[model samples]
Target: MNISTFGLGYVGGVTAACLAKGSHNVIGVDVKGEKVEMINQGKAPFYEKDLDNLISQAVEENRLKATKDVKEAVENSEISLICVGTPSNPDGSLNLDYVKKVCEDIGTALKYKNEFHVVVIRSTILPGSTENVLIPILEKASEKKSSGDFGVCVNPEFMREGQAIYDFFNPERIVIGETDKRSGDHVAQIYNDIHATVIRTDIKTAEMVKYVDNTFHAIKVTFANEIGSVCKRLGIDAHEIMNIFCMDKKLNLSPYYFKPGFAFGGSCLTKDLSALLSKAGELKLSCPLLEAIIPSNQEHIDKVVELIISQNKRRIGVFGLSFKSGTSDTRESPVILAINRLYEKGYAKLFEKGYEISVFDPNLDKSDMENLPSNIVPLLSPSLEEVVEKSEVLVIANNDKDFKRIPSLMREGQVLIDLVKVIEADEVKDGEYIGVCW
Candidate 1:
């Protein structure tokens, strides 16, 4: 593919050389005359590992060249890769001035171009930035519709500064968020020679992937440092402890607890985290990330309660009362905490304003009960039909096998709230469905 790479900074420079090395005709675009001159002279404008030699090779082979004119580059190439910087603003937001300028220049260049072009955004940006901001700018400037006259794709780069060249060829994953299948296909073909996981998703999701990867990296670094602080206070080797901790990849370093859903509850997580924070507090160590865990978890539960309250339904049916599915233990169950808050404290308040919660936990169903249950235990329905019959709002708190049919069982006006994603959006035939985090 003929590629025009805009922005000749760290990411752009390395990308141009590497792509050209992979047997693509790369035309490097930049606003800086010095950078353009350096690239055309087969010299790296900035410092990067192995960049100078690769650029030297690519330029000498006539596969790579640099130009200051955006029009010339865009007109010559089939796909234009926007590799401009999205630096941070003073208020902690992204400053996309460089990206916006490149988009405007490309849009103007596209106005005169006759061939179908795919504009791939390789800069790191927040979700919705590509679709909401850049696409509109292209449309306005080019006087052409995106995904029609031209195509758009957000292809975020994951190159570390020093190891950029190595990371490019041996990427863990390649994300191509495209407006159309044709655009995605074109972008994916760019990496056909590389052995990496290629993920094709919507434009917004692809844009968000970069931010999530970076944020998680920041979290991991802070978490390690905080543990190091705590270990230093206890006269323990932090490196050894972390190495041992990381060795349990099945639970510690794996995707065991990374799902985007309800607050974490259960005996182990809450208990262990609390103990660690308490010990850290005794040493007067301020671990903000560790400190925020409990409150952040509580806030998630509070949001669930708030969602239930927002439904304005008096009769509420809760499916699976335990912290998770297949568990009989109710110790520190988040759903139980949510239910406890729903009940009225006094007799005066009980009759005034409170929800009627009917729970149907397969593990907690007392078939031997002859009488009604208490306010704490709530109404434990013997059958799923009984809970479905009595409640106006049904909340699925866990992933019990019995709750799988709840979406299909929803009545006309009832609201089915799913915290564990047990029910699909299209499964609910009658009532409105809502996912807690989703």
Candidate 2:
């Protein structure tokens, strides 16, 4: 591939040198005359590990060169890679001035170039930026329809600063997002000999993947720091704790709680979190992340109450009233909060004289009956059929085996408000199959 790399920064210079060493004819372009002269003289413009020798060798072999003229670079190369910087603004938004200016230059260069040239953006950008912003700029400046007269692709780079040369040669994955199949295929051929997973996706998803990887990295760093702070205050070794925590790959660091659904509430989680928060307060150490956990949990409970209020139905049936399934402990149960709010709001009443408000739980203990509200009824239905016949809105709060059978017993007009998501049944057709957090 005849390649022209723009913006002779860390990523650009290293990539041009490596590709040139791999026998690709490369032209490196930049606005700085000093950098161009340095690269032309068989010297690396930027400092990187093992990059100087590679650049010197590529330039000496006549496979790589540098220039300031964008037109000359575009005219000689078959594909151009944009590696410009996206600095941050004062208001925390991204400043894409460098990207916009380079796009304009490339577009203008394409206006006179007769051959179909591929423009690949290797700059890190937010989602929808390539299609929403860059494509329109290219279309306006080139005076040609993209993918018809030329090709465009976004190939995001994932290189560390000091180890860029190593990362360029050995990447975890290569993502190529193209405007057309020809552009995608042409861009992919450059990595024909590389030993990495090649993923071809749409432009927006490709653009977002870079940000997601970086943001998740930042979050992990902060989380570890927070744990370290708490451990240091308590005279405990944080690294040893984390090492043991990470060893449980199934739940601790894996996809155990990665789902986007309802809030969590159980005897152990709620009790442990409250104790840790109280300990943080006694030490007078401000742990914002730790402090926010209990409130965030409370917010989920409040949301369930609000959703029940939004239904506007007077008659409600709640199944599985305990904190969770297979337990009779009602302390801090989220469903109790929902039921209390409904009773206070005048929308809920006790079971009518003959029309019993049906409830079922395979694990509810008679000793825990004191936790029930004074006004609510406690008619324990042994079977789901009797429960389905009594209430208009069914709230499944637990994952009991009996609750799973309630969906099979569901009538047409009854609404199912699932908090634990046990049944695969629709409540009031499609509109009322409400999951508490789904």
Backbone clash total for model 2 is 0
lDDT of 2 by residue, 96-166 (tens): 88998999999999999999989899998877788889888988999988898889899999999898888
What TM-score does prediction 1 earn? Answer: 0.95
Per-model tally of clashing residue pairs: 0, 0
Q: In model 1, how many backbone clashes occur?
A: 0
Checking candidate 2 for backbone clashes, the offending pairs are none
List residue ranges in candidate 1 displaced over 4 A: 344-354, 365-374
| Top candidate when judged by lDDT against the true structure | 1
- Among all candidates shown, the one with the greatest TM-score: 1
What is the per-residue lDDT of model 1 for residues 1-438, given as tens digits with 9 covering 90 to 100?
899999999989999999999969999999899999999999999998999999999999999999999999999999999998888999999999999989999999999988999999999888888888999999999999999999999999999989999999999999999999999999999998999999999998998888899999999999999999999999999999999998998999899878777778878999999999999989999999999999999989888888988887788888887788887777778887887666533222433565477888888645423222345463677788889889998899888888888877777999999998888889999989999987
What's the lDDT for candidate 2? 0.81
